[model samples]
Target chain A: MSRYVLRRVVESAVTLILATIVVFAGIRALPGDPARTLAGEESDPATLAAIRATYGLDEPLPVQYLRYVQKAATGDLGRSPRTGLPVAESIGHALPVTLQLAVFAIAIAVLMGIGTGVVAAVRRRRPAEWGANAIALLGLSVPNFWFGQMAILALAIAYPLLPASGFVSVFEDPVESFRHLLMPATVLGTGLAAIIMRQTRSAMLDALTADYVRTARAKGLSSAQVVLGHALRNSLIVVITVVGLQLGALISGAVVTEQLFVLPGFGKLTIDAVFTRDYPMIQGVVLVTATAYIVINLVVDLLYSVIDPRIRVGGPAL
Target chain B: MSLLEVQDLTVRFRTEEGPVLAVDEASFSVATREVVALVGESGCGKSVTALALTDLLPRNASVAGAIQLNGVRPSPRARGRDIAYIFQEPMTSLNPVLTVGRQIGEVLKRHQGASSRARIIELLELVGIPLPGRRIGEYPHQLSGGMRQRVMIAMAVACRPKLLVADEPTTALDVTVQAGILDVLRNLRDEIGTALLLITHDLGVVADIADRVVVMYAGRVIEQAGVHRLFAHPTHPYTRGLLDAVPTPGRPVLKEIPGRVPVMRATSDACTFADRCWRVTEQCRSVRPVLEPGPAGHPARCWHPLGGKE
Candidate 1:
């Protein structure tokens, strides 16, 4: 187990470095000069030069990347070229909001997905299964941005159930933070929830008819016991895989939902940085995202081994 | 009194092609502590009969029959407590992700309550698994085919069920493994007084372990008798064909049962096995012979059953 952990950590470290390089190059490749954008077109050459030097934009591309990497190694993410605020401090604020929203979305997705999937599988061809399937279809069909817009219109403008646009620290006010997070989280989660439901339902359908499930039934287990204990337990590997894939999609593409709700998460920060050509801030956001993806995958692999002993510790699958 | 009595059990599956009769009017019984072998080839509906005993057939199937255990209708609660099943292909039959101990523990816990770990080990040992302690933590993939079948046996007998219905239990094991499995089953029958409804197409298996034999052909019980009487007399043409198919020590050429079991779209009064029977006649073609006492002195659904004098 330790050896497997060590290997995965090392591989992730290498991938992280590669990701940083890609992001650094990608930000540089965008049209328009960061120096010009910050200094304004009316600024003289001297002002542009000064702005460039302040953010290390005047340096060669490799030197700038190396300096950025060096600073990142020491937890210094530099300053935004557009706003001149410390990138790390800005991220320190935005990261929590995005993380909280993502966590909420994932939890909601997993719970609803597995719950409805179980219902559909157990009820089978009954009306309950049809209802669950119909709901899952709607969840998958609607676009996230459209869903988020609809939610804002209904909950904020029409009903006034929540504030239309805002930011609140979960620590500062838990209820308000939840109120702010709920609509956007649900909107973001719907797509993933549908995918998970589809996967779970199919996997469970198979497990229900599996030989072991028959054995469990022959053992005099109640329907509840058979479905939950024997069938659902075996179907978890597929659900876990779906969760991992959907989670990756969530972290990387939660931008649209964040934009609709104006949640002031990394999505907003990264988008603003792109429009204004804030190279350092964009790089910082991308770094955080890449690290998160790696960690989430590692956690998923661990979960697999936990559920199925045959997959444990990189040993021969016994 | 019979431990299990199944009367006129009929199973029909509603497929896209239309309703098909899988098992028709199949009747058999197992007396307390007796071994009754339900013998047939694949698609002969023996497995359907076994599944029908527990009402475990898939949703598409409609079963009409009377099944009673100990002279009373077996409730769903009686499934694991009173009647247990050991299906074919032990590797797939046992849950792969579960430890050998936990899988057996499930039965012990469900029918009973709070199954102790020691009890699981005891069940494992009962089926002849050595080092039950070490084997407890291992998954199904870790064990050999015979060992897994033993685990299956252990699970089936966990509640000391009155009747254990095993569907081709030993058919999936090696020749060497088959004997060990039969031994475990025989021991369970002898020691615990559990009636066994053994389903198999192998006459060798029936001869080795069965006290009574029920022969099925094309979804009907063609013949049934004491194992010795059936072996010696060989009444129905289908039963004789089945017996002849088994290879003997000096028989250079083994006989084979011709043709396949037809998929019955409509259950007809016509003899279903006439197409494949050697002794088929005009009356046999036009009529479904009632399985009744005849010159052979046991029930056979054949107009001209072979004499028992041989």
Candidate 2:
């Protein structure tokens, strides 16, 4: 297990390096120059030169990549071109908000999805299965952005129940922060829940038909025990994989949701940086998202051993 | 009195194409301290009949007629405590995610309510799994195929069921391992005195372990007699064909049963085996022959018995 973990960590590091190179190349290849975007038309050439030099934008591509790698290795993500603030510091401030939203959304999605999945699988051929399936379809079909806008319109503008936009720090007042987060989380989480629920239901249905389940029943176990004991444990592996893949999407979803709710999360920060051409902030956010994706997959892969011992990470046993 | 008496039991599956008759009105019994082998080829409803005994048939299947266990008609919903089924594929029969001990312990907890750790270990050791203390923590995938089948047997016998139905238990195993598994089952029968219902297509396996044998063809029992009588002087043409098919060492080239078992399209009013029988006649094709005594308490389902001595 330790060897497996070590191997995964090394693979993740390589993935992160590849991702950094790709993101850097793509951003640098964009049409508009960062120097031009930073300095307006009224600025003198010398001032532009100075600005470019200060940001190290005038360096060769190879040299610029080296500096970028160096800074990332040391946890210094350079300074934002728009705000002229340290990119790491800006992201640090925004990350907590995004993390809070993502965690809450995922928690709700997993709980509700797995619960409804178990119910649907157990009550197969019943009205509950149809109802759960319908809900899942609705969740999958409705876009998160549209859902967010509709939720804001319905709950904030018309009903006047929730605050329409803006975020409150949880440290200031936990209850107020929760209230601010509730609607966005619901909108973002609904789609994830639907996906997970559908997968879980399907996996559970397949597991229930397995020979072991029949053996469990032949042992005189009750219907509930047969489903939960034999079916659910095996079915959870697929659900876990789906949930892990969704973590990346959840972070991405938080960006649009944060914008709608006016929450200062990584999503909102990245969007702001994109509009102003803040290369440092944009790179920093992308790096963090990439890291999150790699790490979540690594964790999910490690969990496979615990869920089903037959899956060995280091290839077939020697 | 027989420990298990299944009389005129019929099982059918409702498929999208049509209603397929899986197990045609089959009747047989297992007496206490006796081993009865239900022998047949694949798709002859041998496994389905065993499954029906424990109400383990699939959802679309409809089972009718009487299945009395210890004088009580056991329903599909309430059969586990009295009748337990060991399926063909031992590799898949045990839960992959669960430990062998827990899988066996589940039967105890469910039927006998034996929840103590010590009791589970005791049951594990009883099935010949080594180092029950350390091995109890290992999952089904950790064990070998033979060990897994032992775990399956342990689970089936956990409740001390009156009748144990083994559906081709050794079919998935190698020849050498097959004998060991059969020995384990035979020993269990001798030790616990539980009536054993062994279902298989292998005549050689039945010859070695079974006291009585019921030969089936086209989802119907064609012959049943003591093992000695069936082997020494077989009656039904299907039984004779099955015996002829088994290859014997140092014997001249074996006789093969020409053509496959006929598929039952509609409920047969005539002999189901008439299509494949070399001695088939107009009467054989026109009238279905029910089981009747041949010799030495042997019952053969045929108009004309094979082996003229009978």
Chain B structural similarity (TM-score) per candidate: 0.97, 0.95
Error of 1 at A90 (Å): 0.9
Fraction of native A-B contacts kept, per candidate? 0.60, 0.75
lDDT measured at residue B158 in model 1 versus the true structure, 0 to 100? 91
Give the runs in model 1 whose Cα sits over 4 Å from its true position.
A313-318, B308-310
Q: Pick the TM-score winner.
A: 1
lDDT of 2 by residue, B1-310 (tens): 8888989888888888888888788999999979999998887888888888877787889989898987988865455667877888888888888877777777777777666679878767877788989878877777778888888887788777788899899999989889888988888888887779999989889999999998888889889999998998888888888888899888878998777876565678899888788888899988989899875458889888886553
The C-alpha local distance difference test score for the whole of candidate 2 amounts to 0.85
Indicate the residue-level lDDT of B288 in model 1. Answer: 76
Q: Which prediction has the highest DockQ against the true structure?
A: 2
Model 1 chain B: ten consecutive residues of lowest lDDT: B301-310
The candidate maximizing lDDT is 1
Give per-residue CA lDDT, model 2, range A1-318, as digits (tens). 788778889999999999999989989888787787788867789988998999998989889999999989999999887887898999899999988888889888988899999999988889999999999999999998899889888999899888877777778888888888889888989999999999999999999899888888888888888887789998999999999988878887888898888888899888888888888888999998899899999989999878877775333331
The segments of candidate 2 whose C-alpha lies over 4 angstroms from its true place after superposition are A158-161, A168-174, A313-318, B75-80, B307-310
